[model samples]
Target: MNRTKILYSAAAFIAFSFLAGVTLQHATAEFVPEWVKNTAKWYGEGKTSEVEFVNAIKYLIENNIIVLELDQKKTESKTSPTFENIIIPNGNSKVGNVGFYIPLNLEIEKGTTVVWINDDNIEHTVQSQDEKGNLISLFNSDLLRTGERFAHKFNDDGAYHYFCTIHPWRVGVVTVS
Candidate 1:
């Protein structure tokens, strides 16, 4: 592991230890081994190896003393759709179909950024439009060729309807709340 990763692990270990002390009211002395603290201190002070620090954290986690729910966070954690980038499918412009965009509608939380990539051979544009097909002026991308991309971060909460200027029928919506 790199020095930065070691430092970050040490910091998270200390923070979890502190949290365990406050939350584990029924925790016994056996739950928090003194060697773990020593290992964390030594690792943070550059006196211990990364493997030792990682082992100590593993021991605590295995014992169920510090259950980390940080990674289990929902929509907030997933900034984009399941597929990171929306693929402008092949033969998308030739015919107008319901599934023109890979994922027709993307529902995400506020402060999430969405990316659209033109994976087709022809050119395309990502522009925000209203329900009646009028331009909302929220965002507009330049004409993008194959393998080109456009990205926008949604800070406000609303349903964003976007369409390709070249192929008006190829549309997608991103609902941010």
Candidate 2:
């Protein structure tokens, strides 16, 4: 009830609340991708197409690579969308294809959905497997025709390896954090 005691208690409460608010506000951890600089340079030099450049920018923004502290309404900040996808290119079925799926290895945050679109002119399946070439039964997709996509939402932190049952050599990985 004394003036000094009351003042000290109020200060301590305010400090504790401030620290808690800071922690809550930073719940989403953001990181910068190392390839962004090189990609930007390539775009500036006309090596990369406009669509590719735009897609890179969207990937950065949506994935929180470029964090923008916007002081606006709550819903306004959530407008940026998440677009994570892998493309099974036309010649993906071929054995020893270096780039069977565009960016054969992907790193994403938890709760992110990754889609593998079959751009090839053949049927394929996305079957999850262990690193030792054994099926782990995590995710399995039906036969995907050309233009069909198989999507999986990763909710945990681990490396998920998948391959096409028809073409086992066609393998890719999604690492979630």
Where model 1 places Cα greater than 4 Å from the true spot, the runs are 1-84, 96-99
**In candidate 1, how many Å is residue 25 off?**
29
Quote the positional error of residue 113 for candidate 1 in Å.
0.9
lDDT of 2 by residue, 1-177 (tens): 445434433343333335434221221212434354445446666677756655655565577644544445675767454569999889899886664788799999888889999989989899999989897789999899999999888989999999998898888989999
User: For each candidate, what is the lDDT?
Assistant: 0.75, 0.72
Q: What tens digits encode model 1's per-residue C-alpha lDDT throughout 116-139? A: 988888899999999998877899
In model 1, pairs of residues that clash are none
As for candidate 2, its clashing pairs are none
- TM-scores for every candidate against the unseen true structure: 0.52, 0.54
Q: What global local distance difference test value does model 1 have?
A: 0.75
The best candidate in terms of lDDT: 1
